[model samples]
Target: MNSPLTIGVFDSGFGGLTVLRALLPLIPGARYLYLGDTARLPYGSKSRETIARYALSSGRFLLEQGAEHLVVACNTATALALEDLKADLPIPVTGVIAPGAAAAQAVGAAGHVLVLATTATVQSGAYTRALEARGLAATEKACPLLVPLVEEGWLEATPETIAVTAEVLRIYLAEAMAEAPQATSLLLGCTHYPLLKPLIEETLRRLDYPLRLIDSADATAQAVAGQIGTRAAVGVATSTAFYATDSIEKFQRLGSRFLGQVLPPVSLIDLGG
Candidate 1:
């Protein structure tokens, strides 16, 4: 490619910044347009029809901003509206679920695999279907507390907070491992989870559970790079423009944590419900 590609990434909130963080080093030449539908978040509690509608609205907004490809960064949106976005949008569309399962398979994850995700994602069973479709058995566990803990910066905070986070992870992993004793890999089913990878690995080590960790954010970035057929271009720095439906200040603060870098000015755009 002679010039950089324009890619659109959509998510319900700050978590999707992890996907963008993974994309930067992999495809350093691409221009990214990220939209966080902050106003109508918690898509988890919404109906499937509503989620598809919201996701389609976000995708269309990104397309209008000159996006050539779309990445559905939110697990809930990916599970519920991926097909809808693919059908309605003209450009290539990728979601978090398939790439994650494919990553597990790529790493020689055979037999059973354990998945840690949000309650809504677990209820949707998207990871299980994706893994099973790839001939790998999957057990999904919902760690509803993990997302909030990560968002609150409990990871590597005060000793008390970190200990609480670790204990929660230990409990979740203990139950998940007991359910899938044969699991050789553990898929991090939420974008927010990549931030907790070290702790997760530590907990696994403590439990003597040797499940390889798979981060969907990394997997999805690799998938996007493959779809575009280009990689990091030397001397070609990547650029990103951030947009959010509500709370630009908060998005900048929390999003910086997920992206591992300070965010630029976030333009506020209203996408009505």
Candidate 2:
């Protein structure tokens, strides 16, 4: 019998679990190997060379685990090191940026496409370039706090936590809208932001901002499905392996929030800083 298809996903931290969550339904019956380089995370603050080196290491580790294709699920890694990864890795590679921009373009987001991403991703201008390359105007907002709020399990834990997160979303949305009043699409450029989608929609409604939301995680999953085709659906059951460079307990604990399901046993691995 043929072996099950294996797809590898790499992220600086467990935020990429959101991408994996998006992939579960779209590309069922495939083995997933996910690596969260938690030890050396915050890839956003690192230099380009350092980020590329880290990404390549993570990609190669997944390939060694029998991954046939790789997904760079972190926006910072995708923005900084996707090209390097594609060039060095033998397997097909996908990132969260281009697919998102294409998704926005497909929805006829022509006048202005607002991007909500990490400060590093915004500084890289990756989303802006991708959107404009497709003839869509791009406006990127650096939402640095959203990641922490999501990671902290503040999405609706309590009235106080929910209010804090909602207020932050309200402030960010208000600021972003002030800059791109004509924005027709608001792209969630960070993987962690998917957890806040409902709240974001609600906040948008509260603020009377009607920009369509574009989730990069879902878009990337669809792109992966399109690339791998139906062969990925051959197996009877889908399996996933989780790995983290540091803090296996923390990875499993916080990762479930992003993945929207209980995570299985996670292995600890070291890739060296």
Which candidate wins on TM-score?
Answer: 2
> Which stretches of model 2 miss by more than 4 angstroms?
233-235
What are the lDDT scores of the predictions, listed in order?
Answer: 0.91, 0.93
lDDT of 2 by residue, 3-41 (tens): 778999999998899889989888778999999999997
State the weakest 10-residue window (summed lDDT) of model 1: 228-237
- Over 4 Å off in model 1, which ranges? 1-3, 231-236
The Cα error of candidate 2 at residue 136, in Å, is: 0.3
lDDT of 1 by residue, 1-273 (tens): 456688999999988999999888777788899999999987877888999999999999999999999999999999888999999999999999999999999999987889999888888999999999999999999998998898888997799999999999999999998888999999999998999999998888989998889999999999998888874445667889999999999999999998989999999998898
Best by lDDT: 2
Candidate 2 CA-lDDT value:
0.93
